[model samples]
Target: METLANLESFVRSAETGSFSAAGRRLALTPAAVSRNVAMLERNLGVRLFQRSTRKLTLTEAGERFLASIGGNLDALQAAIAAMSNDHGEPAGVLKVSLAPSFGVAYVMPLLPDFLQRYPAIRPEWHFENRAIDLIAEGFDAAIGGGFELAPGLVSRPLAPAHIVAVASPAYLRERTLPADPAMLNVMDGIVMRSGRTGRTRHWTMRDAAGNEVATTMRERIVVSDPAAMREAALLGLGVALLAVPDVLPWIERGELVRVLPRWYADAGAISLYYPTRTLMPGKTRAFIDHVVEAFRRDGLAQRLAGSLGL
Candidate 1:
């Protein structure tokens, strides 16, 4: 049988489209991954990949080989891990992806307890704002929403991704509060620009009475990140549309006030995502259970609903 390392290197490199990214997932050096792939190719008497300075592409033989072996690799690894009793202690690197603002505010606190429970598991987390391909990127799990639910993946709802209009108390002190969502157009607006599209987003606000109004604001400040938008609002620059979970603390502390108390935008649900495998790693399973339980216990889902009363 070929070495497990060689097979793992080849599989991860193919999935991530580069040896460097595969190395990050496997905890191996890029040179080490390349060497393993080379040894595998030498033994099989076929070139597995077409290598160029700019990119790596699989050969026809490589594509066929990957198709035959890709799905089986996880099962095989799980079996080996089970046999070696790695599952007993739930040990290994646990890689996860998360949105920066949300992860830092809510999830990071759970790390202390998580580590205490599973001392053998090491966490390697990436804080990013874009959707991620969990399987291709070799992430054990991810937290956020708007991810494509591709095959072999599962998403569990954590909280409602509801957006509510907010502004600093100082900014609202002198100005008249809008009687309806349409009036927001005349106010200074701090808007978010889509990182992927570079266009400002507009949302239709819905009231508890089943009334919907499309609100367009005069853009006084524009930012690419949600956190930056929040800061701009806090600076009394303009009104900002933000997720309730992000500004809940500020609202409670009298730092920020809701612009339209009865209206909110339904942006979908924040979810925890993971690979849908029967033989999932113990560390991943543990983390998922921990997060779900915590959210439920804290009533985070109910608390995060921006339109709770309406």
Candidate 2:
């Protein structure tokens, strides 16, 4: 019988593509991950991975091993969950990944209450703009905005995210407000890029006639961080296209003014996603339930609607 610890290290290292990354998730050192995998390889008497300077590729033997053991591993996890379910207490470390701005503005504030409720569960949070591979990255859950989701993940809607075009009061005072999407081409605009893809996202909007249009404005500044973009817009650097929830406080305080009111971009729904598995850990399940209930009770949608003057 394979030891659970060795099996876990093997599975995580295989999925993450690097021992260093797997180690980070497992709270082990790279050398420890390597040793664990080496032990597994010795017991099985075959090479699992083909290691090279640039990448780690699974060998035929490794692929077969993973296919054979994947279900057993899942069953083991489910069995553990079943055993722990009797306790009826959320106790464990919950690792979550989230979009930087939304995590800071909305989720972080709510976490204090959650932590207080579940004192036994320690939460580890990571905020980034890039899409995370939940299973491979060993994240228990992820909170994100936008529609595109990878396969084999279950997503639950958290809240509706509304976005609008905004500029500093100074910028609006000097330049004529763009009446339509076509006029935005002549103005300096800020664009956001994906850290992994290195491609700038085009702003999606609708005209007065309800025609869907995609516009990529000339970029005076390209920022990877959404918070930095908001700051730049506040400094009158350029027109900023931002999520309404993210910029609402600033707009309410008159630091920024909503531009192109007639043409508003559709704000994508914010969702919490996790790997599709038959059994979810108690802590993860509890956290998701808490988030849903909190958002419902807080009237987040109503608050957002009021902010947008809708």
- Best by lDDT, which number? 1
TM-score of each: 0.86, 0.76
| lDDT for 47 (candidate 2) | 97
Over the stretch 231-253, how does candidate 2's per-residue lDDT look in tens digits? 99999999878887778889889
Q: Which pairs clash inside model 1? A: none
lDDT of 1 by residue, 161-228 (tens): 99999999899999999988899998999999887888999999998888999999999999888889
Each model's Cα RMSD: 3.0, 4.2
- Model 1 lDDT at residue 16: 82
lDDT of model 2, residue 306: 20
lDDT of 2: 0.80
